[model samples]
Target: MIVSDPATPHRREGFESAPDPRLYNDDLAPTEPIRRTWTTYNYLALWFSMSMEVTTYMLASSLIAGGMNWKQAVLTILLGNVIVLIPMLLNAHAGAKYGIPFPVFVRASFGPMGANIPAILRAIVACGWFGIQSWIGGQAIAQMVAVLAPSTTGSPVVTWVCFLGFWALNMFVIWRGVESIRFLQSFSAPFMLIMSGLLLFFMLHKAGGFGPMLSAPSHFATHSAFWHFFFPSLTAMVGYWATLSLNIPDFTRYAKNQESQLVGQAFGLPVAMVLYSFIGIACTSASTIVFGRPIWSPVELLGEFHQPFLAFLGLVALLIATLNVNIGANVVGPSNDISNLAPSVISFRTGGLITGFLGLAMMPWKLMASFGSYVFGWLVGYSGLLGPVAGIMVADYFLVRGTQLDTYSLYRRGGMYEYSKGINPAAMISLVVGVAAALVGRVMPLVSFLYDYAWFVGFFLSGALYFVMMLGHRVRRSAVVS
Candidate 1:
């Protein structure tokens, strides 16, 4: 039962009276309603900041390079983001309703101890993303440094110095905590949008307008070829965001209400993604006309400008954009996830620090070396792993529990969530089955399409399996008053 205080009417009474020491910590505790101040604008700003990064540019341009026309490329990105938004909003509902982060929220379906499985999996992926974004930010810094001091150009030491310096900046922000991220995103979103528009204006002027910029014909020779490539590219696009589809609760837990999260995400995600992706596609297509070849990397494209001041400004914008995405998208979930493990021992700051160090160890430079490796191998590969987790979370929350979570029980041992010693076999088994089905194509050449459609296959198969497996199992209704 929720005990309302007259003085703090908005604050939902949590398990604060006495929560299990083994399972509870300040960081993992349910958010007080009074503290849930994030509004629709905050969520909109969050997506806008995240969407205007170098990776999103690469994602769109890579599609064009892979043989699609500019129109085809933008359409794919639009459709993919729209598809992923469904799951994104679904998972966010639990967070908004329960005022709990993803780790605590997952305890309902995965069990308290078993929740660590998905938490760790999601954390590892966030580490890789952290590394990638840091590398991009570092490259921007190095480019600026090289412009200022011509002699430092192509120097490995200078590159490493800039990389480490940029990495440190990200860590400093993470150390400041989540509110810093909110401030950063809210402050940077409009500025990044303006910078993106300026970049687009420059590209359009260079290419002599959209006629030449988007004139490139589709490279697919036949209808069959286009269809064949479309499915995987669509899947790759969906896979690009599959990570966030599961961990969205980490952010939405702070939302003032479900309407704020849902409407904000609806207005923010797909629109920003499509708009920025269009900028990327147009700029890249324009590059072929201006530079005599396609230059996909924005950093490299900026370097072509002979005016050091112009390049410096562009690089600065890129730096801010990278930092916004890295801190907001990459750091939050992993910090919360890592803190969930031994909550008494590790705090969010410590978990973020661990994430930073592990990101360096991932050697993200190698991952970003080629477009094929980055898009097909890395994006699609991780999507296969995360899709099932999303499937189970959505199925369990919306279908099984009817979006009602027992908040008090979530942070206690020997509660409704303590399935078979704190591990839900049904969820585990379904996750394994989902992953196997989605990834089977990797081993069996004939069914390789399964790997292409990794996210869809894993999501549907696992959600169905979990629903069936959960039948006849007793689920306790939420005790926390709404």
Candidate 2:
């Protein structure tokens, strides 16, 4: 039954209403319209800052290293991003319309307590990413040190120091709050673009020309071989941003309106990813001609430069890019997810600090040890876990509830979302089934395609299952104030 509290003035706003202390906190509250100030430019800048990082470069360059040429790798990245953007936009809608973060927004589908299952799962992945990005940033710092003092090059002691120092910088930013991230992304996006352009120009010149740089032929001998590689690679590409595809509400909740977040992300995500990835492909291809072998690591490539001054500038750009992405993409989601565990006790700053410590424990250096491990093992692996969550969320919001959420009930203990003792059995069952289906290919060689197409399989399977399971479930309408 749809419940209405006509006597309450702020029924829909979810503010100025008494909420369960266990579920309500200032950080997790539905944002007021007045506080929704993020415009299209802000989101555009957000993606621009995020996509210019070393990992995006590695994501493309790894595909090149795997076998495909520049053209094929670029197209795969473009298609994957476009596919993921659909889920991103769909999920972002709730955040903008309801003005709630991912954790709170998820309660509508997962129920109040069960929401933590997916939130923690997502947080763990973000912690892994935080570690990976921090490791890259530390490498950049270590490279800068090498340029100054050659003896310190490859020193494990110096590397550890740089890594922890970089990690500390990320924590400092988190302490300052979310608005600081907005300011950081806005200021860094354009500068990072300029730096990327310079790097592209340098690579082209060094490799003789664009033709020589991109002249590499496909290593795949047969159509079958290429197709076999393509599916998983494409999945990895999609999986790359699959994390954001689920947690975008964390950012979009602050958007000024639907148009701003929608248009900003539409323009920013794919364009920035494809453009910057093209740079990675072109530069990595150029590396083969310039260095006589593929130099996929930009950090290592910069080290080959004769001038320390130029290398220093390149490292500095990398530092900014890594920091921008690590904080914006990695820190925000996990911090909020952790806060959801105990909203009254854990604040955003505390959650961010915990994320940093967990990032260290994840040992990112081993995760990025090889291109195969980074793309196939890590990227594809997490996608299998997160895809089902996305499917459940999108299905619950659009298919079942029709995007109408009782915003106030979200924070109340016995409200509309309190299904079956604060957990929705159907959502949980669908999630497990979806994850198992996507990952079963690992153990069963015959069904390996499921693993290769992990994200797509999990997304569709869970979404359909959830839709069917919710067929008889009654929809709850939001309260209307008289």
Candidate 3:
């Protein structure tokens, strides 16, 4: 009944000398293979969309809340970006070199069957965050709707309706898959920039100048309390954004070449983040003067506006912006991860839908309301694992493996990645030990002062543990063979 086309090119044959072609697409073969797929400008737009969102603004303000002056706060943000740049650049190079997602790339270091461990962990984190961000975006929508319809706003039923409506809308777009995502991003990125510009113009008009906005906060009575608050907040900002740095390969795999990947990171990440941080400062500062209260949430500030049309438009823009960030930075990486676990059963679109559905069902508002601060701190501590995993991967690939990955080993169980019965004990031990060491301070209040440096601690511990374990394993195996 079916005849294969004799002239059809073999799927793997068309792949350009890359370690893995699956990296290029979201594991879905393009109707026609994309040769000249992405440009530098596309990446610039991506980073801009990533940074110019309510979550980013909220985090930046948190840094200010930590008692750092504007200058120190900005520096702390910059340092965090720089700290993440190491793994970001390495991971992007691997993606551009291999044309695969991060989960697939890890097969080189973790081994084929071993790769699933990191993949599952990453997917879990992404799914949790997807639910959280969507719920947050839903709350913004509900609040904006209430502003428009004051009569209906007070009812709990109306709030749930708005949340479900926004949730369904995001699912519709996500289900349409990558092309729809690209198109949604096209309008979203430009619209957010325009909105930010409008907010900045309004702030300048309302607050007099930028200098007064930055210097106005002199409420801290003690220098020690100020620095104490400032450092952790700064570290938190770094840790939160550090999530993106680990997953940068998710997007860079589509890059036309290595040069394009480098250019994208160089131009895209820092510049876009800095601009967003500045706008957040200006907008929040203006809100303080105009509303006479420090309105941390952008939607809250927008809600205070008398004009219903403007308020509605702002929420719409925010919704688009939030979705853009969540899908690119949060959803895509994990979706591919889930598919990696079961390619035949779980298509990329299906995986994305699973994440999106779970996100909607979870209802992040209750979590945020009850445990926002502790949750934020925990996420930061958790992300420290990324730094070490990343370091070990880089060391393994470039230093140990000499930039050559056995691609086929990733598909075959008990091959390159599988160590003992489909698990890599060395890798597992490193992750567990590093995680425990990083969080020991947090769990034990007597030594909680060390909790803030969890990122660095986890990173070093994971790398050291991995290297030593692997070295010992190699030696034992060699002695037995001899």
RMSD of each: 2.9, 2.6, 5.5
Task: Compose the digit string of candidate 3's lDDT tens values, residues 1-482.
Answer: 11112112132334433223332333722222264366786777777888888777776665555455666667777777666666678777766665556777777667656677777766766776777677668777887868877776657787677667776776776677766656655667778889888877877777787765766564578988776665555456656655566566667767777788788777777777778887776677667777787666787787788878877887878888988887777778778777777776787888888877766565566545522362245456656556556656766666555555544444445544567766677777777787777677878988665567676777777877787777755555446446
| Residue 61, model 2: Cα distance from true site in angstroms | 0.2
lDDT for each residue of candidate 1 in 446-476, tens digit (9 for 90 to 100): 9999998998999999989998898756343
What would the TM-score be for candidate 3 when compared with the true structure? 0.87
The deviation in Å at residue 137 for candidate 1 is 0.7
The TM-score measured for candidate 1 stands at 0.95
lDDT of 2 at 57: 96
What lDDT would candidate 2 get against the real structure? 0.91
lDDT of each: 0.89, 0.91, 0.67
C-alpha RMSD (angstroms) for model 1: 2.9
- Model 1: runs farther than 4 Å from truth? 1-17, 474-482
Q: Is candidate 2 or candidate 3 better by lDDT?
A: 2
lDDT by residue (tens digit), candidate 2, 149-208? 999999999999999999999999999999989988998999999999999999999999
The TM-score of predicted model 2 comes to 0.96
Candidate 3 deviant stretches above 4 angstroms: 1-36, 370-378, 472-482
Superposed Cα deviation of residue 355, candidate 2 (Å): 0.6
